[model samples]
Target: MPRIIDSNDKNLIGDKVKALRKAKKMSQQTLSDRLETMAIYVCRGSISRIEDKSRTVTDIELYGISKVLETPIESFFES
Candidate 1:
C-alpha cells in the first residue's frame, strides 16, 4: 500500500509537542522515560523526530505525550 499524507509534515502536533516539552523543562530523554512509565515505548530519538515533524504519531503515543506533558490532547492542535 502507498502512504497517505494530508499535510506537508508527517504530523500536526510536532511544534506543539516541542513547545509543551520545553515549557515543562523536559528533555527528549526525560519525556521518553515518562512515556515508558505509561508503557508507551517512544525512545528519545523518536521523540526528537516527533518534535521535528519527521515522524507519524500513533493515537496511543499522542495520549502518552499529553499525559506526560500534563496537557490535554486537544492542546496539541491549538494555536
Candidate 2:
C-alpha cells in the first residue's frame, strides 16, 4: 500500500529521520549503505536532500529509512 503523506509530513518525517540517524551516530554514507543492502538505492546526497526538506521522499525510501533507524513508519509522523 502507498503511504499517504502530506507536505507537512515531509518536513516532520525528515526531521525525525535526521534525529534518529544522529542518535545512532551514523553518517549519511552509513545509512545509505544500509539502505543499499536492503535493495533501496538512496545515496548520501539524497539523504541530505530529504533531511534538509529539499526533496519529497517516496514511501519506499521512507520504509528503508524506518528500517535503518529501527523506527516504525508512523513514528515519522508522531509529535
Candidate 3:
C-alpha cells in the first residue's frame, strides 16, 4: 500500500487550501479537475484528505494549486 502521512503530521496547507477553494467557490472535485489540467492528478478523496489535514501534498501539486486558484504560494504560509 502507499503511504500518506505519519499519523502525527498534519497537512500544513490544508486550512489554506480549504479557505481558498471556498473563496473561489470551488469544490474538491472541481479543484482536482483543475489540478489535472496542470498535470497533477489528485483524486477527489485525496483532495478531501488534503483539506482535512490528513494527507500530504507535493511541491508540484502546490504549484498547480497556486496557479489554478490564482493565489500566491505565499498566501498558504500566511496566518
Candidate 4:
C-alpha cells in the first residue's frame, strides 16, 4: 500500500523538525551538511522553506532527514 501525506501533515512534520533541530542547537547549514553526507542534496533555503510551511517534503526525503537527525518519524507527530 502507498502512504499518502497531505500538505498540512507535511507542514506539521516540518515544524517538528525545525523545533527539534533548534533544541539540538543545530543550524540549517549544519543540517544541510549532514544531509549532504547522506547523499541528500538539500539546501538551507529548502530547510527554511520546509520549516516555514512553504514546501511539501517527500517521504523519502523525510525518512533520510529523520535518520540524520537521529529522530524517529513518529517523533515528528508526537504532540
Question: lDDT tens string, model 3, 36-55?
Answer: 98789999999999888888
After best superposition, candidate 2 residue 28: deviation in angstroms?
Answer: 0.6
Q: RMSD of each candidate? A: 1.9, 4.1, 4.0, 3.5
Q: Estimate, for each residue in 8-68, the C-alpha lDDT of model 2 and write its tens digit.
A: 4445577888899999999999999999999999999989988988778888988989998
Highest lDDT: give the candidate number: 1
lDDT: worst 10-residue window of model 1 = 1-10
* Candidate 4 wrong stretches, greater than 4 Å: 1-10
lDDT of 1 at 19: 93
* Per-residue lDDT of candidate 1, residues 2-29 (tens digit): 5576656899999999999999999999
Clashing pairs in 1: none
TM-score of each: 0.90, 0.84, 0.86, 0.82
Clashes of 2: 0
Residue 48 local lDDT, model 3: 91
Better of 2 and 3 by TM-score: 3
Q: Report the C-alpha lDDT of model 4 over 8-51, residue by residue, as the tens digit.
A: 44466778888889988999999999988888888999999888
Question: Candidate 3, which segments miss by more than 4 Å at Cα?
Answer: 1-7
The global Cα lDDT (0 to 1) of model 3 is 0.89
